[model samples]
Target: MADDKSKRDFRDRDRVSADEDYEVEYFAAKAGVTPQQVKELIAKHGNQRETLEREAKALRGNG
Candidate 1:
């Protein structure tokens, strides 16, 4: 069977994709941080969703 590249299974919803602009933007907006900040967070803390969220909140003085 051919792979469906257009389909998003959301299997990795619990993690953020640093390479995907949409995922970074969504996370940034939700975390009250800029997209650039989200990228930096991904770099500094890795792509784990909870870690990024906690760090982003800290950046925004919310955590």
Candidate 2:
């Protein structure tokens, strides 16, 4: 069975910007997902730093 957390669309790729640098594990923790998932999202999306910020905001209930 898959983790219920993994089933959720927690990572917001649209909020990511292209000119920022973010740590993989940090982003994953912020996004409530796995680091590998964060990496995949970064690869599929464009901006990583922006995404990380967005994920952080989401985690903080600010996004």
Per-residue alpha-carbon lDDT of candidate 2 for residues 1-63, written as tens digits (9 for 90 to 100): 323434657574445422233545655666676666565565665545665555545545732
Clash totals for all candidate models: 0, 2
CA shift of 29, model 2, Å = 0.4
In candidate 1, the residue pairs with backbone N, CA or C atoms under 3 Å apart (3 or more residues apart, or in different chains) clash, namely none
Best by lDDT: 1
Taking the tens digit of each residue's C-alpha lDDT, what string does model 1 give over 1-63?
433558879778689988888888989888888999999999999999989988887888954
TM-score of model 1 relative to the true fold?
Answer: 0.80
What does candidate 2 score on TM?
A: 0.42
Task: Give, for candidate 1, the lowest lDDT window spanning 10 residues.
Answer: 1-10
Q: Tell me the spans in candidate 1 whose CA falls farther than 4 Å from its real position.
A: 1-10
Give the Cα lDDT of each candidate. 0.85, 0.54
For candidate 1, the lDDT comes to: 0.85
| Candidate 1 displacement at residue 50 in angstroms | 0.5
